[model samples]
Target chain A: MKRVEGLTHSYRFSWFALILAALGSGVLLLIVAPLAALVLSTSFGELSQAAADAQVIQSIRLTLSAALTATLISTVAGIPLSYVLARKEFFGKTALLAIIDLPIIIPHSAAGIALLTVIGRRSLLGSVTGGLMGSAAGIAVAMAFVSVPFLINAARAGFLAVPERLEKVGRSLGASPWRVFFTVSLPMAWRDIVSGMILMWARGISEFGAVIIIAYHPMTTPVMVFQRFNDYGLAYARSVAVLLIIICVAIFVVVRFLARPTQEAQDA
Target chain B: MLELRSLSKQLGLFTIADLNLRLNHGEYFVLLGPSGVGKTVLIEMVAGFITPDAGRILCEGQDITNSPPEARDFAVVYQDYALFPHLAVAANIAYGLRARGVQSKQAAARVRALAEKLNIAALLNRRVGGLSGGEQQRVALARALAPRPRLLLLDEPLAAVDIGLRARLRHELRCIHQQTGTTFLHVTHDPDDALYLADRVGVMLEGSIRQVATPQELFRAPSDAAVAEFLGMRNIMTVDSASEGVCQVGRVEIHAALADESTSYVWIKPEEILLSRQPFDSSARNQFRCVVAGWENSGPLLAVRISSGDLTLTALVTYESFSELGIDAGTELYCTFKSSAVHCF
Candidate 1:
């Protein structure tokens, strides 16, 4: 058998592999135990009851739809930003990238407060949006605020991986700039863009601190889980959490299966 | 027909200054240079990707220096053969047609015709990402020709293809040019490519066109030292003395009725130097005794490096000649050549 890079071989298995396996299992258990325990703690009866609750169903629908909305809006706006960031060189590019990442680095509650200051009822933007507080739009704004960086970064990487020569070839083939973007750049980078959208959507659906502060009344699934935990204790929250995990996992798997390999990945 | 007049660009650390070149209709004009000579910048400038700071571009007698790439109506094949990974071969070829508002059926027909001409018809339905380097090159060529632009620019198109396939592709490119009758401006570093494909060959160095001529003229009569060296001439000698129609070069006196005066650089092509075992009568003006200091196999020929006293020169000898003369290192030989073969600049 051939030896892989970064792996040292002995009789059958390498010492590096053996140690990695042993050490990785500990971290794996630390993450998987909590999720497994949550699922195990919830009975089928409790899960069905939680699923049947009107507030639970409403929050689930609200969460998925808000996430979808935020992802769609980000896809439309973030793709251009990512494409420019990937292809253009300008003063303050690094600073712009850092600013895009500010929401992720800052505490989620702090991020929510920042959004409120911009789009709250008393502000100019709040009036323009008919006041964002406690509205579905507020929830989306909060979700987008915390999740857009993931989309931008992923899409930027995708665009960067695409050879600039391809775009030039398109131009030389008599394609207008906009036409080239739509026909060549977008399709070539779609796999990464789709992956980015999925990541943003997943992150948005799970958002709690930001969404709760912006729109607590119209609770998303995560916010509802928190409400259930605060009002009825751990048991109700655990069941809701288990159900949400199953839904998110199913969607994630389906999306991943549908995505074709990117050009860079295929070349590698 | 295309012309670039006094074009200039200052791209950090490199500059292309006052570069001028012209292409006749249906001509294969090759800009041959070593890598990093800013050949790409010149091509991009003509393609309208890089606007020249100080010159005008003319195509078919129209001044189009400020036109965008799409409006320029010129196609290009990049070095990497940048086929669209998202599209199949047919779709990639059809892209230019679709962009120009050609009907779908017409575009498909054009795509199929180009694919067949490029011998890529069987691979038309396959995704471009899965193609080999040569196949991708053909797909890119097909795409560039699908629109039938007035001129085509190829930037080191064979630079990424397999070496073994290059000679055959070179022949195919010449055939394609004849069949299409489109003007082509191909940039490459390979002298063989220029000699084989160009109707006119231009040597570029340091961001400027050093010389341009028909392949035969350029090979036999390079206008400058750079052009001569670029054309693979290695027997460059300095003048030690001068007379009415004679100049002392290396250890031998050269008699040339056509030699230029007021010249410091003298060059002779390596293949032009004749190697003989004994002094023979010939009309050649320069003949001298030299010892073979070293030899290297160059396909069917051997590149022999010889030195007479302080002067060293390289000469090409066929394997048969090398064997018949029993030539090896330290062997004495007589090298003869017409001094008219010496190009002065």
Candidate 2:
């Protein structure tokens, strides 16, 4: 009986495995093919030239710094909001969730217009803060405006995965509400929150339409690529894109390497 | 000591209305109920997670109706154990102590002491995610006990444990209650938890506590039909009429010492009845020539259903006697029980 069952199981497994591999490799090819073509189109000399160009270097730096600042600010503010959304059921919760997802749903250029209405020059918030137009602060705001949903949604999912009973138990053990949040809830959800921040930072680095409208002078890498494509040609633009992609990929790999050990230990 | 005075709460369609209970200090009290009976909600209220709509929660004569869960100092061990996956077993145990601002050295010492007491010393350095259910339970217990809370509320602590380990865990819980002398308010749907671990058992039906008594008293005498049925008393028969010390069950008249004018039903403990092939003379007030209707294997005891006239009674006979009598369907048997064994309510 066992031998017969094993034969049937292996027969079914082979077919399932073949289909799974085919579907998985299809996705892999779709993602990798364009990136590989883009990278291969630019020679090593051209990549080095773009890396050495002071304008390209400045834009990359500005992009990284602005994205990092936006991510840090969003993380500080979004975590609490995410936790609340995950744990609490209040009036307007669905509306609040929809509002959080608005940036993702709307066009990036329209999102830029909305941010300008809120914090650009002559707006109430802008007048209060002495305006953020054509400034690094404006660039960070545009990046944050377009990319914050990823962080909020991921953190919310993480917080939601944590059992409410654990928090209740933590409180019953004499921990204050704040203590429970920091010691129990925050630690449990840290991995998802960190990954969310990474995604937000990556999205912010590649932001173009919103940043172009808000602060084009302190150009991010994506805006610089567009500017160079219009002013110069496709070859120059492609080299800079290659440089940005390499830097982003390198940073992503390093971050993933740093995060892998704790995840592996937990899984083991 | 803890006291709940006319506690009431409206949670959607379920209403815990004007409920009252008092727990003596150092007593192991178990609340037995069916699932969705608002048992967890009641304890959560006592733990200060849910505020009672109108009630006074007095702990050792101090009112704490509105205290936060932390301020109430009542630790809860949830059904799932809910051990922190991010922490090691030792860290999990030390959580309460750290929350109470205990010094690190002292907290570590306390954690070690709890681990030793719970026989989980070896697992202290291991992560909680990989621990078995039993190990997680011990760790949760250690964590709840670390700060020495005045009351420990256990919400179905044994429900998730394997059946083979439940008995041992129940014994351990009894021992821990004795050693700590903390008022334990354990809620569970499993009757074994109440029978084995409770100093006093409260039977909850719907949202209200129907009766509270010692384990023996609860088994021997339940206050209502709901409570009796909840305790697995399957031989309850409606009393058509009662006079003096006798009650009419269908067309059969049975002698019960406790049957009164207001007695609506009479319940006989299955184990208390004796089954014999021949009519053996006994001092029992109730004796009937019954036919063996059906039999079911119930561990060491054979649950033999006997029908006498229109009345049917369940009797638990040892496997030895059952096979000796060679009883089967339609086999003639004489079942006997004393009037003292019958309880009417």
lDDT to native, each model: 0.88, 0.91
List of clashing residue pairs for candidate 1 = none
What is the per-residue lDDT of model 1 for residues B1-345, given as tens digits with 9 covering 90 to 100?
A: 798899999987668999988899999999999998888888898998888889899998999999999998899998888778778889989999998999999999888888888899999888876787778878888899999999999999888777788987788889999999999999999999999999999999988999999999988667776777877778777777666567777657776555556655677778999999999999988888999999998887899999987678899989999999899999999998897786665
Task: Name the 10 consecutive residues with the lowest summed lDDT in model 1 chain A.
Answer: A1-10
Q: Give one clash count per candidate, in the order shown.
A: 0, 0
Measured against the true two-chain complex, the DockQ scores of the candidates, in the order shown, are 0.54, 0.57
Candidate 1 deviant stretches above 4 angstroms: A1-15, A127-130, A262-268, B238-246, B250-252, B255-310, B314-345
- B-chain TM-score of model 1: 0.80
Looking at candidate 2 chain B, the ten consecutive residues that score lowest on lDDT are B128-137
Model 2, DockQ value?
0.57
The TM-score of the first chain in every model comes to 0.92, 0.89
Number of the top candidate by DockQ? 2
Candidate 2 residues A1-268, lDDT tens each?
9999998987775767899999999999999999999998889999999989999999999999999999999999999999999999999999999999999989998888888999987999999998798899999999999999999999999899888988999999999999999998998888789899999999999898898989879778899899889999999899999999999999999997776647524663
